[model samples]
Target: MAKRRKAKQRESRAPRFWGQHAVLAALENPARTIRKLWATHDAIAGIDVPPDLQVEMAGVADLGRLVPQDAPHQGLVIEVEPLADIAIEDLLAGAGDGRPLVILDQVTDPHNAGAIMRSALAFDALGLVTQDRHAPPESGALAKAASGALEILPWCRVVNLARALDQIAEAGFWRIGLAGEADMDLADALGGKRIALILGAEGAGLRPNVASHCDALARLPISDRIESLNVSNAAAIALYAAQNSQESR
Candidate 1:
């Protein structure tokens, strides 16, 4: 009885996804379990609702109150259970196609993480990895920034990033840590190996232990005038470089 009550409470507190793209994506994802949906008539129009799902129609003004004051909810909101966590081992085992992977170390910003996921999807990367303790959970801001990529991208959160790096290395992936101070250009470092691009937070790049775990440290070729690129921008460029490099060989 106690366990059941606790489970019910937890379910009640699940994240509410808003915005047209976020809510629509969640609705389309068969794996996503939607608890409730609220939308203005205009917002719900053209969006196919599941037959068994519960929905409520409300005014745009009322819909605005459901999310952050500044959030662009687009009159649609959904209460959904978070996606189940994926195993790093499962990701590696299914790496026969040689798709690259992205690993984020202590990237706590939801917007940055979401943008990275968008880039990962754009480049057809296998998945993304982050330290469970340091990463952000599913949120409306993240989903909005991702623009629907969040629903498609497989995200894995692990206990120890260094240990996860070790497993990635053992899986025949050439782990390349990105740092502004690195000598080798990202393109030069890529010798057509199945790559796992490791990135860190904005100001402080990869930590010592994380950098040590990587097979090589590489940098993007940019002007020395700027300190460093935003993590998401760096990720997009790296994915493009990796894809182009592999195709050229």
Candidate 2:
């Protein structure tokens, strides 16, 4: 009964998801709970909204007010319960030559995390893992930045990232940490092994202990055009390189 009440409370405070990408993605996810929806008539014209969900017709202005200021709602917004927490063991269990995993260390910015989620899905990653306390919570901005990947991708949060790394290693993953200061290039770090790519927040880079947990540290072969790439961009590049390496092998 207490758990049921907690679930009710959680459902009541569902995050508002705006923009067509975020809203449609949430709608399509079987695991996602749609609490309330406010959308322009045109936004629902061609879309098939769930019969059980209550959708409130509204004007563009009404939709705008439902989300953050100046947020591009794209004429739709929906209050949705965040997906259930995913277990790291579940991710590791599928760690066989399946998609590589991307782990973030202290990537607290929702936008960066969302973009990394987007990239992870694009490159067919197994899942994204983040340290629970150092990661961002589910939010409209994050959903928007993910561009629907939030709904499709498996995102796991763990209390102990170092311990999770140990489990990943035991699952036969070749953990590679991406650092700008690393000596070896990212390509050199890749082989025929199932990869677990680790990226840290921009500027700060990987935490010392987190870097030590990885099997190898690699740097992207970017020229002196810029000092470093954003964490999200770096994630995309690393994922692509890892996936490409697998295909060749």
Q: Which is the leading candidate under lDDT?
A: 2
- Model 2 lDDT tens row, 1-249: 000111223233678889999999999987788898888998889999888889899998888788889999989999877777777777676666557999999998989999999999999998898987889888899999999999888888888999999999898889999999999999999977899999988889999999999999999999988999989999999999998999988
lDDT of 1 by residue, 1-249 (tens): 000111112233788888988899999987678999999998888888999999999988887888889789988999888877677877777777878999999998989999999999999998899997798778888898888888888777789999999999898899999999999999888976799999999998999999999999999999989878999999999999998977887
TM-score of each: 0.94, 0.94
Candidate 2 C-alpha RMSD relative to the actual structure: 3.5
Model 2 residue 20 CA deviation (Å) reads: 0.7
Query: Can you list the residue pairs that collide in candidate 1?
Result: none
lDDT of each: 0.87, 0.87
**Whole-structure CA lDDT of model 2:** 0.87
